[model samples]
Target chain A: MKFAFLILLTASMALAVDKIKLVSTTTDLAWAAQQVAGVHAEVRSLLNGTENPHFVDTVPEFIRLVGEAHIVCLVGMELEIGWMPKVLSRSGNAQVQPGGKGYCEVGSAVTPLEKPTGAIDRSMGDIHPAGNPHFWLSPKALAQASTAIRDALVRVDPQHLADYTKNQQALAKSLEDLHQKNMARLAPALAKLKGPAVIEYHKEFTYFFDAYGIKSFGSIEEKPGIPPSAGRIAEIAVAAQSAGVKLTLAGEYAPSKTLERFSELSGIKAERLATSIQPKGKNKGYIEFQNSLVETVLAALSLN
Target chain B: MLKNRSLLILFSLVCFSQAARPEAAGTGLQISVAGDIVGNFLGTADNRLLPREGEVVLYAPIDQTWDGALNLAAHNEDGEYKFEIHELTIGSSRLIPRSRFKVGQYFLGVGRLNQTHRHDWPFTSAPKVQTQFLYEEGVNDTGAEYSYLWPTPFYLDLTLGITNGWTFGHTHDEGKGPVLPTHYLRLVTYNDLFLDGGLQTGLNYLGRKDSSGNNTSLFGLDLTAKWREAQTLTFLFQSELWYRIYSPAAGDVENTIGFYAYPQYGFSPSWSLGVRVDGYSVLNSKDAGGNNVGSFDYGLVPTFSYKASEFSTIRASYGVKGRLSQGAVSNTEHFLELQAVFILGSHPAHDF
Candidate 1:
């Protein structure tokens, strides 16, 4: 009986040491969590690359995943505003509730852009009054988010603190290396496109544009979440043409007609850029996803 | 007029009290404000265009585990302005494990549509069945609600509640004080469906007693299914059925049944079209003398909505209603309505 009890205890401990379940609201955060947790955690994202994070539905799967999660990471700043509240409320998991020790808002670790001032209303469109939440597009911001995830994981699973720290450091190093290599490859193009004016379909690419030192002339949409009205589109197109903007950028998920209209009116080339790492296929990881974004931007600007 | 003035003062006091609190700016304190305005063009006997209704809602989080909200509305009825407090509720999730406790006056958890705010309804107006059977506003009551999240692999939520039976068509005098309590229970489940869609179903029950010792019970069943492919298109199908039984002191038991079904298709992020069909009927209803007083009403509504942004929406709808009351010939009524809803401040997102 004593031997059997010892064996049972050992087996339970072994199971306890298995991968901690980490759930993230967005694909980018899931990738960062996976990197920081390494083999110590199993990471899953509530949203897919093709789905718009802003409009995710609170499905049953989200509740199930959150209920089993040891930690939940979110972009925060109300990026998941439309569905995260319902998901968390229904999850019934105290560990991932707001203000819980296992809950992490990765956006809080980095300074955000486009924070509104004064009284804000719907006339300004669907804006995150807190700030723009596209910080994952910035490598610096992503590194900070990874570090935050590491700290959160350590708090939830202290036994794997050393491994989390080492993995985070390795991720930071690889990101830095990739950044340097991209800078070298895009130097000539970057020099030519220094503060070059460009038009975009939405406000989602602010962080990426800021990181690459590109000047945003304007967006096709009059406001953040509103579809482009014909009058507003014409107005923006004329402005872009007058400003000598040569390229228009749109997220791969943006409405094709809006991009096409903006490009046609402005006499500029339109390029659809990937917003997140695809769950399947070649662009399945964070590194490849970020690299593709950099290469796409470089190629688009080089043509100009 | 006096009551309306008092309510306005109370509303202002609540707003000012929230504003004066220093903790209102503290972390985890989220406040959201939204407003709805409607304009109607009646093609019936009135045959005139006029501003219909206006409503405002305030939602504030007192802490990480507690939140409160107040809704006030004003509407024109035959050129007279009527004002009322639609809802005032405070909710807390820390009282019980895996449960939420809500207190004060709010929409009763009797049906899916009953809990939804008026401005949030897919159609421009309330369904005829709801208006005929459950009041035009749909079963708002002063209550305490407790919802428990069951420990199941799937999403299953159980809610139990008790409320003052005054608002449930029960006659009560002031001296009577609290006569009877309305009891409510609901079971809700959510599941994933094909094509990246979701299905949610709920069963609800409500039991109440009148000051005259009469008993009334209501049963509701609702289902909602939604499908979306990226931002381009979305499809939604929702249906709800309600049945009620009333036992008076003298007359035989009466039964009332009603249902509404809504199906919507969003061709783009900005445009959506939907239709709603509603039907209600009463059987064996009688007055104190036991004379038959049964009636039936049905309506069909078609709506088109434009979403200007995440926080703003414009909707236009046309409705046709047919009614057959006891001892009267059936008549048809038609009306057109346009509504605009806007959200300001920090509003938490709703569920699918």
Candidate 2:
């Protein structure tokens, strides 16, 4: 009887612990939320890391997650404009609805880059009028996002404010340490590649390129979302060849055929890079994913 | 004059109250405009090229929990421009937990295709079954709806709605002071079948009294399965089945059944192919008073589409339709259609 009583007591206590239900639009945001919330939250991402964030489908499972969540963290800046709005509207969760206290837009924590100064339209190639939303690739920007997410947690659960703040600080320190370590190791190579022009398959790598001091030559796609015409491909090939661009990077989710054709035409080495942490592999954590990306870029440039 | 002034003041106060409350103004206010333009070539006995449809949609957030939208559409009707309101709705999801309420003129949630806009359809033409039962433009009614999300481990949603008994192509006693309201119920569930694949299914029921003191009831079921492999390929299969019963004041019930199936495959980022099969039949040949009414119609459509960008697409489709009266030989009709669609401005993403 004593042993049974003890087991029942422990189970009840476990159930009594109120964990905040958290939902994020992307795997990166979900990782950040988990890091900050620690044991006090349950985090789920709508899209797996392997999928492209911009073209996510608003599946019903996403709505169910949002409907039950106490808070929702998103990269924002219209990065999920294609599907997040519909999911939020259909979720019927007032607490996480836009403008709700539980709605946490981590992107707002950082100053965006590549904001257009002119009138915008589809002619601009599916550009985000709010600016570049790929800031998660930058360690400094991610640190800011963590702080924002921590603050949001405090707002929703003040009882655990201290815990959230402490976790957030720890995450920031770790990120800083990782960034410094990578920068130190790549300092010589980065110096050599400074202002060195490179080609990208899409506009997805602008933030990363800017952070590492690499100049973007041109994109394989004629426009942001538009496919490249043969003439356009030929034009870019000539431009890249003349510019001495040695490396071409494409996201893992980009069309492989296009990347292969671009490489054949431009005579530049093409590399596929992960846009997010692989959900179920060696690069599962944010730090590990960043390390792999930096290492890959360095190797592609023949700097390692 | 005094009453009018009082009503205006009341309306202003309501608006001001919503604007002043920070919580109510959630996420701040946003306004966006979107438009769809289509050019179509219709091939029939009289082959003609025409500018099909131009639609402008406006979305505005009144507050955090409340939003308003208006859809203005212009279509070429017999070489003349006809402008009309496609949808106008004010929706709120904050009144109840895991629930939403929408009121105004909008598409009825009877089936999957009824709630979808023409521009978003994968095929170039509307399915024959849908057009026959809900009219050419689809079923739109002035009404209010409340939908709730069930707190289950899986994805389950239930919706209940009430609307004015005004189905398109049917005229009842419109000038009457009041009539029986149409009632609708819908239950939807979703499941993740495998990696990168999902299945969603729904059941629906609708009951209402027509203008002629007749009872009309409809039962429907819908299923959709989708699979996507990154940016390389995607496949979708969807089907809807509907059965309707109409009972006159002094006759036996009349029964009709309709169904449609659509399958689409995207081979690349810019290219897709789709096929649709539609069929409908009136099951009852005689009423209690012994009236002949049985008929059947069927159609097949195949489409190939190319997307230029996120905002533009071109599609070519071929359709074969057959109509069979109770005592006449089946008459077949064939048509070829080509369409170009372009969207501009900020358009919200559609549901999967």
Best model per TM-score:
2
Overall lDDT per candidate, in order of appearance: 0.78, 0.79
Candidate with maximal DockQ: 2
For model 1, how does the per-residue alpha-carbon lDDT over A100-136 read when each residue is reduced to its tens digit? 7788988888888889887775667777878998888
Off by over 4 Å in 2: A2-17, A194-197, B1-46, B76-80, B166-179, B231-233, B286-296, B324-329
Residue-level lDDT of model 2, residues B219-249, one tens digit each, is 9899988887765348888898988898887
Q: Give the Å shift of residue B281 in candidate 1.
A: 2.9
lDDT of 2 by residue, A1-304 (tens): 9999999999978864678988988888899899999989988988778888887778999999899888999899988888888898888888897778899999999889878776776776877777889898887788888988998899899999999999999999988898888877667776775455578888778777766666788688877767788888888987887787888888887877777777888898888888887778867989888888778778877877
Residue pairs with backbone overlap in model 2: A99-B26, A99-B27
Q: In model 1, what is the error at residue B145, expressed in angstroms?
A: 1.0
